[model samples]
Target: MPLHPACECHTATRSYEFSESHAIRGSTIGMVLSKQAIPDISQNGGKHADFPGAKAPYVSKMKFLNEQSYDPIPIYRVIDNKGQVIDRTEEPRIDNETLLNMYKTMVQLNQMDEILIESQQQGRISMYLTNYGEEGIQVGSGAALLPRDMIFAQYRELGVLLYRGMTVTEIVNQCYGNHEDRDKGRQIPMHFGNKEKNIVTASSPLATQMPQAVGAAYAFKRAPNNERCVICYFGDGAASEGDAHAAFNFAATLQCPVILFCRNNGYAVWTPTNQQYRGDGIAARGLALGLHTIRVDGTDALAVYRAVERAREIAIQNKPVLIESMSYRVGLHSTADFSNNAFRSVEEIQKWAQEENPVEKLRLYLEGKGLWNSDIEKQFAKEARDIVLRTIQEADQKKKAHWKEMLKDVYYVMPQHLQKQMNQMEKHLEKYKEHYPLDQFQSE
Candidate 1:
């Protein structure tokens, strides 16, 4: 609120009040201007050297600010690691049905991740990224938003999609690249998108969705009485991308209604936060860029829900907000990342997995409220696992999209070049019909 409280720059001018007592104390006249003086001077057209870029009062001190000047931004948390609400007033007033749904969604996401990761190892899918310890950040924030609000996600936010009503079958179909997939078997596994759900398709390049989300938010801002806002999710690694800087600056300056959600899960692949950056974290960057910012404990679903609920309200008023959800990545970055050679030790992973697991934390909270028990947990776990397994089996049996389908979607009216290419492919496939597994693919 006071800018950088420890930094003796612009914040120093706004924080102090001008008084006769200060003059009596021989305080520098440059540092004596009160917060009320700025507006009064401006209204009277006083000869203050007002810079077009900055409106801060001139300060007497010549001091340079560094990372150590301010303390790290405190993370907001409604519940502790034991899943007990630290403050009753801070706890969100979620309905029992919604709470159960959120808990179940997170469990389902975890179950899906387990089977899918194993499936990847068994060569059932090409690749997979697990949600692991960040399920609360996904499901909690997802539940706080309106379904109509747009979402632009990085690879690891499957729980958000699940919470937004994406069926397990739809997800498995995409993973298997079956004919029923919304992308028509075009995209790689885990790069999910659904137009009906308002979630943009994930791309492999880091932070590519940031600017796109801001553009969409700008469009929503222009719409009269627009209630919708865009939520763009990325990992801490993605936050280091150049596109992230552009997106933040544009969102702040243009007053776009967007939430830049950063899952600061302790590592950018193998690199830890210490190696990633020197400053406080992604939230500090948002503050410097003029965006409303907050840091939340990613493992606490209730805290995440409360933070995002308030963020959405601010965003709808054309104020962009940045939320840094802090947690640890308890799993390997992806199936490609071998655990034995992982940068983090097994013990560290296990510690976070057991102590700060988002799903387990929510389960404890439910148990405390008399809303859950071992019986319910066992039943839901089995049901979730069965659903994922059944969906995977069905998806495996389904045929791949027709080979010709790929070239068809590129253009509404096929051009001569593409048409010739398609014809050539067809002729080649026909000649080698016996060599190719035609039974595994849909017929033309």
Candidate 2:
């Protein structure tokens, strides 16, 4: 509250005159010193205070006071369906190897999802979720990130983990819940994680990772030396959760480097996106919360790569970003979703498959660039399926974890209550020796 040393004004009138004459109108000094409101231009038919420059026509603030809708957020795209660069000059100049890797990863993901989903249906695994139509967001956005960037992914973002160097065998072991599983068989299939890779364990509860991602980004901000960002992936349905709002607000207010990628895949399982919200989906919420927001076509890997690279560049400067990727859940949401075709029309799915297929789109683009061919693709498809089948078979040979394994990792030392429960279970199992599989409880 200290005044300038040479200031002579001590009276309210002198202060008012000084503020009115020299201070910036609505600027810091004028806002603090003056109480006079700007004249309403609607009454005098002159220039509006809010509108500094005269325009042909302007909507007064009160004119649409009752209106709630805002202008639509524009969609950004770098590539088109016909293997064309629509963004021409602005298109990202990704190297051939990197572009080929993106295409390869999408193919691997497509094959992996198909095999695993079939395995689940055959009851080889308890459950599985497929990223059938959303490989671009996982692969493209993931390819754009640095190695040290923390990634908290939804179940379908297997490509992100793959990009981060998680091996096929490791993922299959996690799916099988074998001895090689990172969580020691504690987590179910698809909830993969590895601290070494900075990929947080995925959760089943919707949007739970949002606040966690925000918290991690805040920690990164505090460290200052990490120079890393937290990129969290969730679906449009997950964005409807309360944690999402809290996470967005905190990230924006704290100016944390959190890149939130919401794959608006047109459904929360079976519930259509239209049934979830009336607003302009998740991107509008991000803008409303002061985060830099963009909506991009999810099927285009090049577009996703460019968009995420830009978002990452901004996030490193301590600004949060929200990317709502418009896609479709063209495959079963989960293995248990046997009635998927009943809830959604087959004709719509066929259209999406024929036109906006993520893997096929990238393949076409790669083929157009002379980076791929029908013969190579055919050979690669066979190799991809073989790798998955071999890995799954190897993981299956490891056998499921014993019941004793589940009670091992919960604490530094086993608590007395848990120990007591284990003792009681051991006694009960001994009494029913012939009623169950003998090796099921036995740790081998």
What TM-score against the true fold does each predicted structure earn? 0.89, 0.86
Off by over 4 Å in 1: 1-49
Q: lDDT of each model, Cα atoms only?
A: 0.89, 0.83
- Show model 2 residue runs off by greater than 4 Å: 1-61, 65-69, 438-444
Kindly list the per-residue Cα lDDT of model 2 for residues 1-444, writing each as its tens digit: 322222132211214334433545645443344434432323223322223344244445655431165677877877777778776786898999999888888888888898998888788889998887888888989999999999998888998888778989999889888777887778879998999999999999999999999999999998996779999999988988999999999999999999999999999988998899977778988877899999998988888999999999999899999999988888888887867688888999999988888788788888888999999999988998899999988877785667777788789999999999889978987899678675633374
Question: What are the per-residue Cα lDDT tens digits for candidate 1 across 1-444?
Answer: 222222322322333565544455656454466565442212112223344575665556798999999999999999888889999988898999999999999989989999998899999889998888899999999999999999999999999999999999999999989899998889989999999899999999999999999999999998948699999999999999999999999999999999999999999988999999888989999999999999999999999999999999999999999999999988888888866345777888888989898888899999999999999899989999999999998988999999888898788899999999999998998899899998999886
Give the per-residue Cα lDDT of candidate 2 at 404. 74
Clashing pairs in 1: none
lDDT of 2: 0.83
Cα lDDT for residue 73, candidate 2: 81
